[model samples]
Structure formats: C-alpha cells, structure tokens
Target: MKKIPETMKALVAYGPGEYKLVTDFPTPDCGPDDIIIKTEGCGICAGDLKCQLGAARFWGDDIQPAYVEPPFIPGHEFLGTVVDKGENVTEYEIGDRLTADQIVPCGECEYCRTGRYWLCEPHNVFGFKNFLNGGMAEYVRYPKTAVLHRVPKGMPLLDALLVEPYGCSKHAVDRAEITNEDFVVISGAGSLGLGMIAYARMKNPAKLVALDILPERLEKAAEFGADVVMNPKGTDVAQKVLEMTGGYGCDVYIEATGHPSSVLQGLKMIRKQGRFIEFSVFAGETSADWSIIGDGKELELRGSQLSPYCFPFVIEHIMNGDLKTAGVVSKTFPLDEWEAAFDCATGKYGDFKIAITF
Candidate 1:
C-alpha cells in the first residue's frame, strides 16, 4: 500500500449550488474506531441535484430547519476498497471491498433505542454534514458508528453502485405492504423508480403499472418489472388508471417522481382505502387538498426515508442475479469533469443514473 497522503482531491459544497473541486483538500484522519477507504466510485442522485439547486429541505426555509451543513462533501451512493483501518477496527481489514449505510445514528436517541435508527433525531446523513464527509472524493472515512457491509469480490461495478438506491427502493416497497391481490402503480421510471418496479414485481401483485413522462425510462421500467407502462404527456393517467380498475383506482401508488403534480395524480388515482408510499425529496414544499386524504378518502399515507436494514438483502440479490442493473447507469465521468456529470444527471444530456469514477 502507498503511504497515506496529507491531502487528496475532493468536491466540497460550501452552499447551495456552490460545489467546487479542490485538489489540495486535506485527507480525513482515522479515529481509533474508524476505517478509511480509497473510493472506487460514487453515483450522482436526484436528491443530490435537488440539494445543489437549493432544495428547502436541504437549505432550510422559514418553515423547516435545514438538514444540510455546508462546507461538506456530497455523494452518498458510493462503494470502495478499504485502504486503512484504525487500531480498534477488527471486523474489516485493509484491501477489503466495503460500503456503509448513508446515515449514521447517534445510537442513544429514542428512535435508535427502539431499533429505528433511520429516524434518529439529529439525522446525521453522510455528505450533508461536515464530520461525515461523503464518497465523492479520492477517499472516505467510515466512523465507528457507521453500519458497514462488505461487497463480494466478484460483484460488477454497476451492480455495486446500485445497492444504495435498490435498498431504498426495497424499503419503499415494504412500506406499501403489497399483497398478491393489489394493483400497484409507481410513478417515475428513473433509477430509483425502476428499482421499485423490480422489487414490487416480487410481490406478485395482480397488475404492476409504471408511469413516467420519458418513454425511454418507461421502456426500462417494463424491462425491469412493470406489466403496463403509461405516459402522462398524451394520456389522462388518473382516468386511465380508474378505467383499468373498474373506476376504483389502483390499490397501491408509490410516488418516486419529485414533481408536485405526481402527488396530485396519486391522490386522484388511488382508491378510497389504498396505500400510498412517498419516497422522493422535493425541491420545495408541496400543497394539496387535505380533504382528498381525509374526507374524500381515508387513504393510508407512508413516507420512507433511507435504507435501514435492507442493504444486506440488496447485496445478496445483486450478487445472485436477482436484481437487474443493465443500462441503469447511463454515463460515467471522471472527477475532473464534475460539471458535465451534474448536467447529465439533471437531464441536460440524458435521463438515467450518472456516476463519477475515481
């Protein structure tokens, strides 16, 4: 192994829309219980794009407090090889392939005490906080509190990059509690939405539908799992869903599109007692008729956060060829070309997952 460098290349976020690449950024130090990884690659996510564009949930507003602490690193969907380990770290060693959960829990919070660490009050997600810098750099440090998992030696880079998103997708599908008799609809055929379609298909729902504005993504959704695909540009999605289900609407609707209109569409296309699972991070607040959720229909609404205990399942499936990852990652860019990478991720050039290779 090469000697640890005093400085390394990194992308730091000083504020919303203010990320810069610095070649001389100081490399993170390893604590007694920490481990350092030489990053292989990191995937650019929609949430990262929203944060870059000044999402209220990330930058904060008069109504909600900010979740992000600027002057931080900002890539969470990542994987790498272990290059250094602290004195107290024993479960892993140098040269091991590894990844960690996006959020690091306090372990003493009320939520953590009950095994619901994803809801830890402080909510210190990697890439958003200064202490927990993310994997958009040449290296990353995993603290003692991180939930670490090892990647198989033979796993492909594309399949490895998808574990994080697919884990979240599995969690969202679990929140829906799909049954064999239910008719499910997932709005959005992006990477995360396509993962949801694959996981939902495992439930053997009566009918699985995917909705998207992009025909290409809809086609990928079909290849992944969706039995029916609909484009809202030329069709009234709500009426079409109603017509297909004898005017009762779909039994389950998962909102993966960050657009506000998808929320309204879900409310209109879900049945009276249907379940709705929301997993997207929006750039701003969304408004809707409260009556639609209460008086109009006693619908069940559930919001899913990060992947909690689903990483293991995702890794196992990916290694076993159960999850499809072909064509999911549309492009890859070197760290020096971060600007173009962001543009491609935000749909300037294409509509698929974009990754930054180390």
Candidate 2:
C-alpha cells in the first residue's frame, strides 16, 4: 500500500484571478464514511476558466448569488485510484480505480427525492466547496454522499479523463431528444461540444452540423461526428442553416460556446417548434429578444446542468472504443504547472481538453 502523507502539493483558488500553488497544503482527511484516492489526472474545464475570470454566473451579482466558494481546489473532471478507505467504507478496496459525480446531492431535497439529484437545491459541487475539495491535488477524499463508480482497471488515461465531460455531454444531448429525421447543429467544438457531437451521432441524425470560430476545432469536430462544419466568423450561420432545411431551419440547436452570440444564433437558426439546449457556463448575462420564443419561433429552450446519471454509460462506451476520445485531450501538465495548463485550456496555445497530471 502507498503510504499516505500529511502534506501534498495543490493549486488553490483564493478569488477571481488569484490561484496559487502550495507545496504544504494539508492532505484531505478520510471520514468514517469517506475514502481517499491518489489522483491520476484532472481536466481543466471552460467553466474553471470562467470561474477564474470572475464570470457573473460564478462570482454573482445583485441579481444572483455566487455559485463558487473561494480558497477551494478547482477541478471536477478527474480520475483517481483508491489509496485509503475509512473503517466504515467497505464498497471499495485500496487498489480500486474510481470516480464520483461532480455534485454531492442532499438526498432529502425535492429534486433528489424525485430521482433528479442533479438539480438538488444547495447543489454542493466538488472543487467549488471547501468541504468537498477536488482532485487537482495529489490526493482527494470522497465522502459517503458521493455517487461513486468503479473505473475499469485497464482504461486508458485519455478515456478516463473524458468521463466527466462526456457524461455532461450525454446529458445535454439527451435533453435535445434528437431523432434520425432531425438536423442538429451544435455550437462550439470544444471538449463538451465535441463529446456532444459524438454522442448525438449515435442517434444518427439526418444532418449533424458543428459551428466554431476556430478552424482547428472545426476540423476536429468533423473527425468526431459533425457532417458539416462551418465558421461563424464570416458565414451567415442562420441563413445557411435555414437554406439547408428548406427555409425551416435546424430541428435542434445546442449552444455550448458560452458566448452570448451563440445563444442569439440558436434562436435565429432553430425551427419554429424546435428544441434548443443551452449548456454553456456563460461569462455574463445574455440579452435575447423574448419575441423569438413567444411570438416568433415558439421554441423550447432547455438548460442542462452537470452530468446527472450518465457516468456509467460514458465509461462503458469509452471502454468499448465506441466514444472517440482520442485527440480530445490535447495536452497534459504537471500540477506545478497549472497556470500553463489553464493557459492552454483558455486557447492561448489552442487546445481541446487540458489535464493536470499528478
């Protein structure tokens, strides 16, 4: 057995734009119902970047309360190996590989009682709360309330790192309720968007379109599943999509870019009775004409939160080589070089998903 240590290296976020690396941060303790694991890797998400930049959704404003707590270790897309289990923890052994859902739901909440734990009212997510410290460090503690899943012992690092994002992607695609006759357009070809394309392809939609401002990401989108790739920079995306659908527009439009423009673009390019799934963590509030929903398109707009119950399916597909995860994790950095990893994730060097290896 690997001996547990008292102190470990970690990257902690104090506030917006104030993340620091500390070598002597205390290792997390294992409660009677908790288990501790040695982290294998943690992926940097666009939401993490938004949190660092003090986006209104995370930092909050007069209209909304902040969702993030400072001085917390920030990473939810992670995988690890069990190193220690408390006396009351018997479901896992020391050598087991596992991961937990991002959110630690309160089982008594209305949403949790109704089998919708992802929408639990206090919504304490790992990496955002002090008590539920995340896997950006060398070791992490998983509480009993966590929804744990055993990862296959032989799963590749890239496939393992993709579990969280793909779970989220699966949930978002499921919200769209795509059919073989529908023309689906997904905006943003980032990690989440690429995963959405891959999962949506399994439904075999008539046309799968991907939109991004970056040429490199658009190329990667094609490899994943997009039948048509378009750049929104110079193209009239809504017009082109409308023309392709005989003036009706795409049957479903999923906004994953987090940019306000993408939301407006979806409103314009969706058929009158289409479903639009908004899954991005936007930097700020987006302004859209209400008429587009009520009088204009009569659209169905749905918001997708964290991955609900899709982890098992994602792990199974990835392990079976059904979900194409290759080239998605474009880079990996050591925990000490977290700043550089964040830079790559924010597109300084142009990346898909960036991981911090332990």
Candidate 3:
C-alpha cells in the first residue's frame, strides 16, 4: 500500500498583529489547470502589512472555516520555478522560472474584455483570500488565468521578485508621459517610488524629484537616479518642486503614496496641462478634493492599477542592465523568519525592499 505524503512549512497570519510559522500543512497537488512551483523568493509589500492589520476586509476580515481560510500564507510578490505540471497544460513545462501577477482576473468579465481586468469581480489572489495559499511556503500553484511570465537567463531571483512592483511603476511612468525635456516629480520614496525613479530616468526626464518623509529613503532614491530628493518635513513639497522647475509646475507627477493629502498636493505641483498618475495599491478608501481637478485645467489624471502591459518591459530592462537592482535589494530572510522580515518592512527599518528567500 502506498503511503500518503504529509506536512510542509508556511508563514501564516494567525490574527491581527500575529503571524506564526506553521508546518502541519499538506503540500499542494496539481489540478488539471494548475502548475506547481517551488518558491525562489518573494517580496514584502506595504499593502501586505495593511492586510495583516485587519484591514484585509477586501477578503472579508472574519476568518472563515474551510480549505481556504485564515492562518493562510500572505505573500503576493513572488518568483519561483515550475516543479510540476498538470495534465493538458502546454504553455509551460517543468523547470521554467516564472513569476505571477497577484490577481488572476476572470477572463469572461466585461472589465477584462475592455482591458480594465483589475476590476474583475471574482478576483483571485495567491497570498490573500481567493487562492489562500501563497509563495511564502515551499511551493505555490498557478491557475491557468494567472499572468505567469518567464524569467530570462541570468536574471537574479531576488530582482525577479520585484517584477510585479516594477511593472506597476513602469505603467505609471508610461501614463505620465515622461519625456527627455519634461521635469517630473515622484511623490513617496518607497519601493514603488524608487522604481518609478529608475524607470523615469530611463526616459531622460529633465529633472526627477523624489519626495518622502525619511532621509534614508530619500538618499536611496537619489542613488537610484533621482535628480533631487526632498524631505517634506522641513520644506514645502510643492514649492520645492516649482523652484526646481524654474517656477513652472512639473510636467508630470507620479503619486505612489495612497495618502489622500499626497494626491491633493500632487495636483498643486503639476503644470496646467501636465499628467498625474496614481499608482498606490491601498486596501481602504482614499479620497481627495476635486476642486483642484475641476476647472478644466486641461490636466490629465490617470489611475495605474496592477500592470497589464509591463512585464515584458521589466524583463527587457533587467536583461539589458538598464534596471540594475543590486542596490534595490537590501535584506533577505529565510522562510522561518518571515515574521521578522514582515515587521522590518512594515516598520520602515531600511531604505530598500525586503524579501524572503526559501
């Protein structure tokens, strides 16, 4: 008689302000439309912190009893290797290095048909409610609809984990229409903010000003190609941006901070016809006064959600050395110490992105 396999280690959220390492879980089995992957590395995002803090109502705050329930893994930004493939799947085979976009949109929805797939009603997330199992474990399963892109040869696994966030920033930069002659302002020097600074630098923006509250993060942003870094604590952010641009408001503004006031302040930093792109992913409601956007200033306001057209570009940059991430990755932790890693990222202990390696 054959014996049944049992047990694997995973980082699970026990409740608000608590995450415990669990080991009595079954390793995932492949389904007809699924492929199993061995996690290489995964990034800790600020949004993940919000989810852990009971702000995860998007998936229902209550812990339900089911195969998919709380005490579930909580990592969405991941990169891994395909270890097993289920029947009828031909796009990928065993041994492929891939990473997935967090949400797997339902392809039949009108929003998907119209290219706004991020709004798909019945969305699935690997690290959150829908999938319930994420890459924080030894393995993860990818459904047919997930946007799994192949990692190029020689690409660092740590940097691969950054693909999702980099894709998002690239999308925002595209929407802002940054140009060689345009002066651009990036609000927030977080991981996503630094990525925008890197992507915008590639387009040769006349000036790339990065605004943030932390001095360490600002210094890191400057190292990542920001023309100037400003700490809003001592200087008026809007005034500094205008002065740097010779009295003309910046030509483009990219807001990566979900803070309402940042978005409102962004409005005052852009030129009459400039573009403003909002790229922050917050779990709760974010509101800003509309009067700044009401007078037909001919300004353009765009919202860049999960990236739909940036994975390939991100890969290209990594391959060509244009998007060096050596400095972007500051620390790494093993699977067992995930709680400590999450705490560091949530507490803003460093100037770079935090990652977990298995």
Candidate 4:
C-alpha cells in the first residue's frame, strides 16, 4: 500500500459566505474503529451552504466563527473510496466504495435508543455544527456507523453522492405516506426539492406539482417527472394547486424551501385531513396561522429532520434505476474550484445541484 500524505487540500469556511481553498491542513487521524476515505465526489448541500453563513444553526450560536476558528470544512454529502482503515475497521477495505450520512449520534442517547438517532440531541453532523473535517477535503475520517452503507455495485460514484439528500427526501415522503395515486406538491426546486421530485416519481403520483421562484429550476423539475411546474412569484399557488387537484388540494405537500412563507403555503395547499411534511430546516421562529388547521381540518404536520432507515431504501431504488439519481445533477466542478461549487449549489448562479469531483 502507498503511504498517505500528512497534509491535504480542502475548502475552509471562516464565516457566512466566506471560504478559501487551503492545501496545507493536516490530515485528520483515524481511530481504531474509523476509516479514512479519499473523497471521489461531494455534493454541496443547501444546509452546508447555509452553514457557511452565520444563519446556520447546526452549531449553536455559542460556537460561532470566533469559537470554531478558520479552516473549517463544510461538505456533508459525499462518496469516496477507503484508502486507510484502523485495526478494527473490518467492514471496509482499501478501494471500497462508500457514502456517508452527515450526522453522528451518540448510541447512548435517548433518540438513538429509540431508533431516531438522526434527531438525537447534541447530534453533530459532519461539516456542519460540531466541527468534523467533512468530505469537501481530500480525506475525512469517521466511525463505521457514520458510514451509512456501501455504494451500489455498478453505480457511478457521482450518482452515489446524491444518495444522502435522496434519503432525506424519502423520509419525508414516507412519513407523509405518499402513494401511487396521491397528488403531491413540492415547494422549492432546490437540490433537496429536486431529490424529492425524483423519489416522488418512483411512486408514480397522479400529479406532481413543483413550486419555485426560478424558471431554470422549474424547467429541470419538469425533466425529473414533475407533472406541472408553477412559479409562485406571480401566481396564487394555493389556488393553482387546488384547481389542479380538482378543488380538493393535494394529498401530500413537501416543503423544502426553509422559508416561513413556503411553510404557510404548504399548510394552505393540503386537503383537509391531508399531510404536510416539512423537509426544510427553518431556524428561528415564525408566525404560523393555525386557524387553517385548527377548525378540525384534520391536517397532519410533520417535521422530518433526516433519513431514518431510509438510506438503504434510497440506495436500492438508485441501484435498480427506479429513481433517476444521475438526472438530478446538472453540473460538476473540480475540488479546487470549491468557491465556485459552493456558489452554484446555493443557487447564486442558477438552479441545479453542483457536484465536486476529485
């Protein structure tokens, strides 16, 4: 086996929207139960973008930039090959393909014991709040549990980079009980929303309504099997969705915009006794008029944090070609152009998922 480098390159964030490519950082050490992955592909997630700015809440306000220091890597969705493993790392060998979930939970936590580890308190997501060198770097180390599962055989590593977000979308759809005949509306054509669009197609919904402010994103949404794409900027989304669903509203609504107004729109677009699953994490409080759901409308509102037993399900779908994982990605960038990748991922240039290839 070849010797590993002592230092490697990575995209470091000092504060909101601030980042620089650094190549001299020390490679993180691998523990007895840990593995070091040589990243092949990384997906710039919305949450990671938000984390670049002070708006991100993954780490409490107390651990702001001043506390974390510079040279902090911020990538969570990624796929790679194992290059080195500690003595006890038996599940993976050198050159094995793998993808990792961002969150690492304490097995002793109440949420972990209850099988809701994704929502465990003090949950530290790699590249986000608690500060772990994430996949944006040339290499990252983590425990076996954080390494969700092996990549599908014969699947491209680039497509595998998408599994993380797709898992999150699956949880939302599954929690809402989406079905073949259900009319589903997804608010936000961002990467997360696009993942929802792709996975929702597997269920063959009666109609899929995609809402976004950008035409470019909506255009892509159509390609991903969205039945009708609506730009809510100048349209009455609630009325349009209602009319599209025969005045009954949609059976399921997934809010991925992380905007309070979008959440309200989701609440209004659900049919009485329907389900609204919030896929976005809107930090801070915003007023929500409960009167719409208070009058015995029998609405079910859910807050889906991340995938819970949905990772393997998404992997199977992608492997079987039931879900269009590759279609969801619109562009790719070399790891050196981390700034450009981050910008494109945040919809600064346009709408579409931006992937980083090493």
Candidate 5:
C-alpha cells in the first residue's frame, strides 16, 4: 500500500464544455464503511464526450437543471487499488485490485427491496452528480453502499476499466434475452456495443449483426465476434437486416449508437414480438412512433440502464479470455495529457477508447 495524500490533481466538469484542471483538490475522506482507492486508470465513456460537446440532455436547458450538478470529477469507468480501508470494512484489504458499479442506491427504496436497485429513486450515479463524484481523480472513496467487485490482482488496468462498460452491456443483453436460435442485431460498434458483441456471441445467436457508420469500427466489430458488420452510411441497413432475416427482421435489437436516428432505425429492423434494448445516453431527446412499438408490431421495448447484477459475469468472461478488449482500448495517456486523451477519444486522432492512467 502507498501513503495517502492530502491533496491531489483532478479534472472537474463545471458544465457543458467547461472544465478546470484542479491540482489542489483535497483527498476524499473514507467513512466508517468506506475504503480509499488509488485510481489506476479511467476511461472516457460516450456520455462523458457528449457532455464536452454541450449536449442539452446532460447539461439541461433553462427549464431543467442538468443531470450532472457542476464541478464534479467526471470519469465513471475506472479501476483502482484499495489503498486504505476503514475499521468496519472486511471485504477489501490494502493493495487489493477492485472496481465498483457507477451508482449507490439507498437500499431502503422499493426498487432496492425487490433487488432492482439500479433504478432506485434516490440512487446516486458516480459521474452524473457531485454527491457521488466519479473516478477521474487520483483518489476516490468507495462507500459501502456501492456495488463493488474484487478483480484479479494481475489484470491489466486497461482491461479492468472495461468492467463497468461490459457490465452495462450485460444488463442490455439480459433485457434482450437472446437465445441460440435468435438473430440479433446490435446498432452500434462503440466500446459498449463492442462488449455487447462479445457477450451476444457467447450466447450463440443464430446470426449476430453489427451496424455502424464508421468502417473502422465496423471492422473492429467483426473482429470482436459479430457475424456480420455493415456500414449504414451508404446502405439501407434496415432492408439488409430484414432481407437477411428472410423479410421478418432480427429477433433482438440493441441500440447503443448514441445517435438520434438509431432508435427508429432499430425499430425498423426488429421483428414482431421481438425484444429491443435501448441503452445509449443521447445528447437530445429522441421521439419515435409509439404505434410501431405496440399497434404496429407489438415489439417488446426495454430500456436498460446502469450495470446491475452483471459485474461477476463480465469479470469472469474477461479473466477467462472469453471476452477480449484488445483493439477496444485504443490508447492510454498520463493524467497530465487530459486534453490530448479527450481529443483522441473524441475522434481527433481516431475513434478509440482512451483512458487516463494515474
């Protein structure tokens, strides 16, 4: 274990397109049931990039307050070493490798009582609000209420940072309920979608399809295990999917494109009574024909939120080599090169999952 610092550098997000690199931020205090973690690495999630682009959905309008209360550290997907633990804690030891789910629920809510705490009315997500500040800092305190996972000690930080994203994918896949005979189509090849590709393939779907506007991402999707990858920029993706499904449409469709057009596009590619999993955090509101969901096709539309009840599966899959994060985690940067890291992640250099290593 390393000596705890009194103050450390951290990146704070004040609002849309506004940030300050703070070098004198006080180290978080560990509560009786909390543990202090030295951040190893943190990845830039799609939602984080959307915030930098000034998306109204995350930043909010004059009528509504932003989901993220300004001035909080903003990296949600992270891994760390358990540097110190409080007296009440026995699950983690100093120098242990670990990560936590992005949210902490009250546990007294009805949703938590039913084992669905992911949607608890008073739950706090790591990055969205200041009360539950995220992992972009050098050190963070993991409260006992957080859903924590003990990762293997020797796992690479790049791969460990992926657990959060893969856990989200697991929830989406659970909502989709794909089987060996179902034809599945995932409408995004970004990091989250790529993880979905790996998990969906493990389910042995009859036909696994990946669609994206970027040829590079589509190629990576194929490499990650999508049976087929398509670039929608110059093709009628819905028509192609329907034709591939013998004019019926795919049995399951998961939308992670983070684009407004993807919702309706997925609607056109899923068959009657098919399951639709929507997980992307869009920058703006998305509207679709309500009739298509019920009257038109009677599709099963499910909205999957944060990672819940899936961390173990993701950790195991990654550890056993069933799920790989080779090309997915594109690059790593030291904490000082924050802007360059964001630039690379936002496609300045190229679209890749960029992480900041401490």
Candidate 6:
C-alpha cells in the first residue's frame, strides 16, 4: 500500500541515563497477522549501549530482572521495507526486504515445541519489552509470531542492518564449535565482535585470535579472518595466548566483548576443555578463578542468547558473498540526529557500526 504515516521519527527510552527524540512517534498497528516495516536501518547495539549505561543486565536488581522496558522503542539492530500488510500477511508482502526475529517466541514454549525458539519462556525481546516495538522507529509492528527475514533486494543499507548482527554471528559461531583443529579466540571488535570474525573464518580456524582494544577494531580483525590481532592492553592476553598456543590455551573462546574485562579475558584464554562462547552483554559482574573455571581449567562455558535459528542462517551468509558485510557500516544517522546518533553509537564518534537512517 505505501500510504501509511501518521507520526514517525522516534527514539523513546526515557529512563536510566535517559533518551528522547520523538517527533510524534505513534505509527504502528497492523495486526491481522501484521507486518508494517518501513524502518530502514537501526543498529546502535552493544545491547543498546548497555541499556544506555544503566546495565544491571539492562537495569534490574540483585538477582536480574530488567531486560529493558523504558519508554520502549530502543532498536534491535534493524532493516526494513514491507510498508504495510496485515489482512493475514502471508509471510510478508508490500515491498518485502525485512528483518525480525528479535526473539518474541512463546509459541507455547518447551522452547516453542523444541525448535528452541531462542529458549522462549515468556521472553519477548524486540527492543526489549513485552513484545516487538522497536527499530529506533518509523513504523515497526511484526506480530503473528514475528520471525521475519526476507532481506535480500540489493542488500547494502548497512548491509540490511547486517541482518541483525549476522544473526548474532550465527549463534556465536554455533556456540564456538569451530574446528579445523580449533584455536579460535575472538574477544570483541564490536558490531557483535565483527560478526564473530566473519563466522569464525568460516570454520577454517587453526589459529584466528583477534582480541581488540581497537586499532581500528584490530584493523577490522585482520580483515575479518584474523590470524592474530591482540591488544589486550599492556599485553599478557593470557600470556599471549600461552605463547600462541604452544603452551596450550584457546581452542575456541569467542566472547564478543560487552566487556567485564572480556569476562576475565575469556577466563584467561580458554583451553582445558576449551569452547568458551559467552557472547557478552555485561555491565557488571565478572569475576574469575572459580579455580580458573574449575580446577584451573575445565572450561566449556557457552551462553550466547538470541538469534536462535540463526535467522535463515544469517540471511544465507549475507546473500551469498559470505559475511563480509561490506565496510562494516562505518556510520550513518538521520532520524533527527538521535543525539548525534547516540554520540556515534557510544564510541564518542568513531569506530564503525552506527546506523539510524530513515
């Protein structure tokens, strides 16, 4: 249809650290199986800058609770088009080009009858609320179980908002099971640790590495494959990965730095039973030495939430050119500046992945 608008530009989140940029906001209602996209590009994550720096797992309590719920409309990575549908939206229509799947499932949990709907259980994390209502905003509403994807059409628009962080880097590199005799690592280079270094270098691992304090994101984590790129500040990144693996350490770490000292530097660079895979989101709480994960090394941690079925496997590796995601969305902003796009998306104003356009 294309003739919808009734109030658009949004940004809400009025609490913890606060935010605001509305310009009439109200514009989302499609329900018969809903659809209504039109967002375009949204990104600004790091869990929306740790729920705007109030993180207690997004502002909760002494035992976790707040999975964000401010004035709503935060942003869940993002991408758009679909302009208006309902009338039983048969798997998307008007103009297509979508991107949903920010959890939302509860389709009668048991993790939605076993497909493990991102571990459903009353979860509903679009921009973190009771249900979908995000994408910084210019209309959003998905509904009918909301698990969209489509997105192909000439990509680029921050590569279709990088299909929501490469579908959370394909579930944190499939829970860090990378092979080729593994050695991995990946701590964090931003933008979901650069899509977990382009899907942990498509499983050819045998070394990979890439820690980051940001030398242009460790030079884009060595052009997204990283054969080694540390900067764990003042070195000793777990004794330089135990002298680059010679003394054994790392065999799949993948934290994605939401920082808590990269979870004690991935519990001192993995290795015993290896396979760490946490995929960060901290803002607090990050101890260490539970005897270095039990008896100075018995690891195998693994946590990675969201992007469950890997949204059509990261939109089929970003529509087949394999996850490079072109120039990692260096920057973009417009929806009324959005506080200078959240001050260049929290990096004060530099270092890629920003998006806000409309």
Model 3 residue 91 CA deviation (Å) reads: 2.2
Q: Which stretches of candidate 3 lie over 4 Å from their true place?
A: 1-5, 56-71, 130-132, 283-287, 296-298
* Cα lDDT over the full model 4: 0.79
Ranking by TM-score: 1, 2, 5, 4, 3, 6
TM-score for all predictions?
Answer: 0.98, 0.98, 0.89, 0.90, 0.96, 0.36
Across 1-358, the per-residue lDDT of candidate 1 in tens digits comes to: 8888989999999998899999999999988999999999999999898888888889888998888987998999999998888999889989999988899898999999999999999889889998899989999999998889999989988889999999999999999999999999999989999889988988999999999998899899999989999999889999999999999999999999988999999999999989999999887778999898888989999999899999999999878867788899888899999988999998655468899998
Backbone-clash count (model 3):
0
Q: Which stretches of candidate 6 lie over 4 Å from their true place?
A: 8-11, 14-46, 53-73, 82-94, 99-162, 167-179, 185-247, 257-262, 265-267, 270-313, 317-358
lDDT of 5 by residue, 235-287 (tens): 89999999988899999999998788899889988899999889998877789
lDDT of 4 by residue, 206-269 (tens): 8888999998889888988899999899899999988887888999998899889898888878
* Model 2 misplaced stretches (Cα beyond 4 Å): none
Model 5 global lDDT (CA atoms, 0 to 1): 0.87
| Per-residue C-alpha lDDT of model 3 across residues 1-358, encoded as one tens digit per residue | 1222456778877666677787876778778888888889888887777777666443453553222356678888888888887797899978889888777888888888898777777666778752547878888878878878999747877778779889888888888888899988899888888888888889998888999888888888888899888887888989878777777798888888777778877887888888888888665666766756757457788888777768999988977878756667678899888878877886467646888998
Question: Cα lDDT of all candidates, in order?
Answer: 0.91, 0.91, 0.79, 0.79, 0.87, 0.79
- Candidate scoring better on TM-score of 1 and 6: 1
Worst 10 residues of 3 by lDDT: 59-68
Return the lDDT, model 3, position 331.
81
How does model 1 score by TM-score? 0.98
Error of 4 at 180 (Å): 3.6
Poorly placed runs, candidate 5 (over 4 Å): 62-64
